[model samples]
Target chain A: MIDFAKDVRLWFAPSRLKDEGDTPDYRFSLANERTFLAWIRTALALVGGGFAVDQFLPDLRWGVRVGMAFALLAVGAACALRAVNHWVRCERAMRRHEDLPLSRFPVVLSLGVGLVAVAMVVVVLLGWTSGR
Target chain B: MSGPGTDRDAGLQPERTRLAWRRTTLASSVVAVLALRQALRGSGSSTEVAGAAVIVLIWLVFLWVAHRRIRALATGRPPGLAPRSALAVVGCTVALAVFAMAVIL
Candidate 1:
């Protein structure tokens, strides 16, 4: 595990970063920053979806309602955390002239979202049958 | 390639990044508004009022951070984002999401 004290220091201090590597091209860094922002927006949208599900779907069974909301909320939180971690890692990679780190996060995220969509369809059909 | 001003022109990368920051700032603002609406929508008790106030405060902090980054990107040769500032932005976002969950639950 990463040293918690060191992680805290890195979060609060700028001195350690200057020694990480050479500065990368401005355009690449800008692109990385934009990517981070995009992920953040994605997280926000997911969280908003969670709120919508909880607030607007009072007709939904309580178990389904809370479950879906929590699922979205949890993914949103994960995305927010990943956004910054990825940004930092990318920045470091660029500075060091190394290959950008790759992860299965995008694939997992897509699958997770697809599963949620499928769940929503089932819930909607169930609600239709019960309401009528 | 030939002239001094040509290199700095560089095809609008900074401009695009600045616009992205602006877009995110607006998006976060909408989220904060939604969270605040949720908090105060019904018979808002004192606790709800306090939560709403905190939501606004966190949103303002995010706005401030984004505004700084946006302004920085307006320059032709913008410096890299400070680590602390990046941490602040992420912290605000995570905090906002947590508060949103709290409001819901």
Candidate 2:
């Protein structure tokens, strides 16, 4: 039978995993960690922005309010998930002595933010035209 | 793997990384405080208050973990790339987002 206990330990403790390839410089690994943290903070900022928009902004149509809030939260959730995935990919690549994987996160994130900005503009215009 | 001598010679890499961690933690704390303020200003419902409290608690925990990591780096200890606490912080942040969404909607 497979050792579930060992599998659990490995799953929880990435540090315990054996090194696969030549060790890269500690600087690179530290940099990777810092990048991951930056992404997490970005995600937090998006989430906070979502909450603020929903709470503080004058009430738009129900649909628009909900849509914008969902969009922001969705992007934030996606960013958080990507942060973890990028961290894992970078760690694996470093372990294997492979070139770091290319990340499309910045592009996707900017696109999402741009869409949200456009939506907000539309929302503001709608609110201005409609008396409420 | 960095030896102690090499770590000392590394010329502020660890220090910069530690600072990055601190900055991230500070950002999270700011977000948490904003959330708390929003919750209080709004309906002041129990769940919103609870959610804000949880966020503040999680941010504190993150700061503590970042502190530990900085100390480890200062001592030239290789404390691994990702700590479980970092994962916990991510999880909590995501949860906070979801809770905020629910409250808003």
Candidate 3:
């Protein structure tokens, strides 16, 4: 928990992340950078999905629409935060020659997306039935 | 066992990274356009207009940064991304997501 607090504080101090240890191989850093960019893109897609659901699903019930859109938006925000934190941790570890950090985020993200997809299927079926 | 010291894949890494940046820039552009569309199509209240403007600014900043990074990678030995620049990119991404959520709400 202490580490988490320090990271939150570090949000305002970006330069400090690179201040420690020697710079690792440029390729490794570039790979890390690309990974960070990928995560950011994923976050953008999720946020886009949120608004798309909100705007495209005019027939969706109000409560369900907002709930779904909010869920997507929340996940997007979380992903954005995770991307930066992971990038910082990876960069620091590389500079210090420590083992790369591990995370369960990919598994969790997949599960969350799966759950949303299932809910979407149910919502679609309900819409079909209600119209008939 | 190829390692970091190996030069067998020289240039490829940076090339891929540059491509990734380009793709991300395109993705962000799409999101920005969508957000703008939402803002205009909605009630067009002053707050929504301001929010849209902020999103546009963030998008432009991100594009500039990504474009700069892409150009840097074209060199034989591109420097590592600055920590501050990494933070700036992440900030723009998060801000974009927040604005998108706001538009939805």
TM-score winner among the candidates?
Answer: 1
Off by over 4 Å in 3: A9-11, A128-132, B1-11, B43-45
TM-scores vs. true structure, each candidate: 0.90, 0.82, 0.88
Candidate numbers, best TM-score first, in rank order: 1, 3, 2
* Per-model DockQ against the true two-chain complex: 0.69, 0.56, 0.62
**Model 2: per-residue Cα lDDT over B1-105, one tens digit each:** 666475463467778788887887787777777667766765778876787777677767777877788787776635555547557667767876776776676
> Please, what are the lDDT tens digits per residue for candidate 1 over residues B2-92?
3554456457888888888888888888888778878888788899889989988988899898889888876668888877777777787
Worst 10 residues of 3 chain A by lDDT: A123-132
Question: All predictions: root-mean-square deviation over Cα?
Answer: 2.7, 4.6, 4.0
Q: What is the interface RMSD of each candidate, in Å?
A: 1.3, 1.9, 1.6
Error of 2 at A96 (Å): 0.6
**On DockQ, who's better, 1 or 3?**
1
Kindly report the docking quality category of candidate 1.
medium
Q: lDDT for each of the candidates? A: 0.81, 0.73, 0.83
Clashes of each: 0, 0, 0
Candidate 3: residue B84 lDDT (0-100): 67
TM-score of chain B of each: 0.86, 0.76, 0.80
